[model samples]
Target: NKIVLPVASSGIAALLLPGGRTAHSRFNIPIDLKATSTCHITPGTMLAELIEKAALIIWDEAPMTHMHAFEALDKSLRDILSLHDPKAKTLPFGGKTVLLGGDFRQILPVIPQGTRAEIVSASISHSYLWESCHKFTLQKNMRLSEDEKEFSNYVLRVGDGNPLPTEVNEFDEDEEDQLISIDRTLVEELSSDPHKQILEATYGRTDQWKGTK
Candidate 1:
C-alpha cells in the first residue's frame, strides 16, 4: 500500500491494477509491465517522477505477480519515463529498487498465462537484481500455529530446493474450466442465440484476453 499508493501521490503515471480488490470497485488491475517497458520511447509522466525520485518501489507481494508483469511494466516505463526509440514499444523502471517483501517460500504470483508460478522468470530470480538476491525468513511464527508451521515446514523439507511450493490454488480445477466456460446466459440476452456461442468462442483466446482467462 505504501509503495504503490505513495507513488500515486507523486503524480506519476499510476495504474491501480485489476483484481485483488472488489471486482466492482477499483482493484481491477489493468496489467503490470515493469520488465520490458523501457525508457526509450517517451518521457515519464508526472506521477512517474515520484517513483523516479523515490528510493524504492516496495512491492509487498511480488511473488503473486505474473510472468509478463515486468514486461508490462517495461511498457509503462516507456510510457512514463524514457523510451527505447521514438517508435519502440517497451519500458523499464530504470534501476528502481523493487523491495519485494513476502516470503519466496510462501505463496507465488498471479499468473494468468497458466505457467507454473515458479516459471515466471526462471532465468532471473528475485536476488539476481544486482549482485546476489537476499533471503530473510521470519525468526518467529507470526501468522501460523506451531502445528501448522510444522506441517508447512515438513512440506518445504519434502521438496527441498526443487521449487517453491504453492499455497491455496485460489480456484479449483473445476472453476478454472468454467471462467473460460461459455457465458451462455449473457450471450443469449445480449445477442442472437446463434451468434452468442460464436462471440463466446472469440473471447476465449486473444492477446488482450490472455490476462482475463
Candidate 2:
C-alpha cells in the first residue's frame, strides 16, 4: 500500500483521500487510539487487519518514519497477533512477510513534535523494526525516455548503485525560472498592431530594405 497521505491512506489520519474513503472503507486498518506515530508504519487495528488478511504487506515510501513511530507500529502488530480476540488482546505481526518501498531520497512524515526517522535506520545487526525479507525491485521505469532511461541505467550500475545525478537538487532548492520579463517596448509592440514597422520587419532589414541585403 502507498503509505503516503496523498493517494491511499489510513482513515484515522484522514490523509488526502480524494473521494473520502473512510479508514475502515478502503482496508480494515485502524489506529490504536493509544498509539501515535512520528513516522508511518503498520500497527494497531490497521496493521492487525493487514496481517490477518494479506499474504504480503508492502510498506512503500515509509522509511522516513521516526524511531518511536517504528516502535509504535512494532508493538501494534505484535499486540494484534498475540491476542486471541482482536478486542481482547494484541498479536505479533511476527512470522509475517513485509516489503518496504521508497527512494530514501523523497519526502518524509512530520509528527507534531518528533524527529525524522531514518531508513536503513537501525544500527542493530540484523535488526527488525518489524521488517521482513523476500525483497523485490522494479528495474524498469516507463516515465523516462530513451536517452534518460539509458543514462539512468548506466549511472545505477557504475555509481553507488543509486543512480540519481549529482545535479539533482532538493525540492526546496532554487530552480532556473522559466518566466521572462520582457521590457515595456516589447509589450507595447505586441498589444498594438498586426503590421507595425518592427513587427512587419522580415529580419534586421525590413521588406522595404530586403533587396539591399
Candidate 3:
C-alpha cells in the first residue's frame, strides 16, 4: 500500500479520508513555506523527509484556500523533490500525485471586506498551477434521498445564480427592497415543535428518532 498524506482546507476532509484531516498550513514535508511580499515560495531550512515517504497527497475543500497558498506549496514541493530527483523539479507537484477535490458551488475563498475581483483572484482557479489541473466531475448528490433528487438539482441551479421557480416565492420584488417572504403556513408548522420536526426530518422517520432514544 502506498503511503498517502491526507490534508484539507477544512474539516470536510475528515469524512473523505481514513487518515483523518491535516490543516493545509500544517501539511508540510518537514519544511515551512514562509509567505512574503512576492508570490514566489521561499523554502525554510529543513530536510523534506516526508516527500520521500508519502506516495500521494489528497487535499479536500481546496477552493476555500487562497491561490497564493497553492502556488507557494507547488514551488516548495518542487524544490524539495528536486533534492531527491533532478527531473522531479519539472513535474507537477514534484512528480507526486495530488488529488484536490472541492465543489465550486460550495464555500469559496473568504476575502473579508474584499471586492468581487479580490474574491475571484483568491480562488484556486486563479493559481499559477491551475492550468495543469485535470478536471473531474462528481454528478451524484450522495447526501440527498431519491425523493429529494429533484430538490437537489434545483438547489444546485439556484447556487449557480439561476432563478428559482415562481411557486417557491423566495423573494418579493414588489415589497420594500425585495424582502424575503416566508409562507405563513410553513412558518407556523416550523415554529411549533421545531426540534421534534427537525429530528423526524433528519432521520426521515419518527420511528428512527425514537429508536435512537
Candidate 4:
C-alpha cells in the first residue's frame, strides 16, 4: 500500500486527519534550528525507510511552522533518498510530493518577541524551497451554511485587514494602519468580574454546573 503521511504544525490540527502526527514529532526536527539544519533522522533507520517509501505527505497548518523546519526535512529527505537514487540528492524533499494547506492571512510562524519582518522571514514562504511549491486557493467556504455566509465573509475581510465602510470614517484618510469595527451584536459587555462572567457565559451559572461533573 502507498504510504501517505499526514502531519500538522499543531497537535489540534494533527488530530483532524487520519493517523496524523505533528510534523516536528514525526520528523524529529530540532527545537533550536539554524539556516542550515537537518532533521534528526538517521539514514537506514525505520523512519528513513518509511520516508523512502512514502508516496505523499500532507502538511496542515503549514503556515504556522518555521521555514527552518521545512528546510531541515528537505535536507534529511535528500540525504536519505540519495542512498538509492543519486539524483534525489538535488531534488526538493528527495522529489517526494508534499501538499501544504494553510491560509497566510491567519496565524503565521510565531517568533517569540519577533518583529513583523522577523516573523515574515521565518515563514515557509520566504524559504528557498518555496520557489518549487505550487499554490492553490479555495474560493468558497463550503463548511459554512447559507445563513452563515455573510458572517464568514466578514471574518475573511477582518482577517485580510480590510476595514468595513462603517469604520472608514473613524480613521484618517492617510492612515497606514487598518482599523476594523466589530458589529455591536457580536460584542458582549462583561461586568466587574470579567473572567467569572466569561466562564459563566461559556459553561452556564455556577449553580447549574455545581456537582454535575
Full-model lDDT for every candidate? 0.42, 0.43, 0.68, 0.90
The sequence of per-residue lDDT tens digits that candidate 3 reaches over residues 82-180 is 886899789877888888988888878888899879888779898768888999998888999998876776667756756343443554556433333
RMSD of 2: 13.8
Best by lDDT: 4
Q: Which candidate, 2 or 4, has the higher TM-score?
A: 4
- Model 2 lDDT tens row, 1-213: 433222122343334434434323333333432235322333455644545555654444444433343345455555555554564233234434444554434434445454434334321112354344445566776667876765555545443434333343444335323222333333444435556546555453354665665
Judged by TM-score, which candidate is best? 4
Backbone clash pairs in model 4 (N, Cα, C under 3 Å; residues 3+ apart or in different chains), count = 0
Estimate TM-scores for all models. 0.40, 0.39, 0.72, 0.88
Error of 3 at 20 (Å): 2.3
Model 4: how far is 140 from its true place, Å? 2.3
Give the CA lDDT, 0 to 100, for residue 54 in model 3. Answer: 78
Candidate no. 3 TM-score: 0.72
Candidate order (lDDT): 4, 3, 2, 1
Candidate 4, superposed: residue stretches over 4 Å from native: 165-178, 191-197, 200-211
Task: Give the least accurate 10-residue stretch of model 3, judged by summed lDDT.
Answer: 29-38
Q: Which pairs of residues collide in candidate 3?
A: none
What local lDDT score does residue 58 receive in model 1, on the 0 to 100 scale?
47
For model 2, what is the C-alpha lDDT against the true structure? 0.43
Which of candidates 2 and 3 reaches a greater lDDT? 3
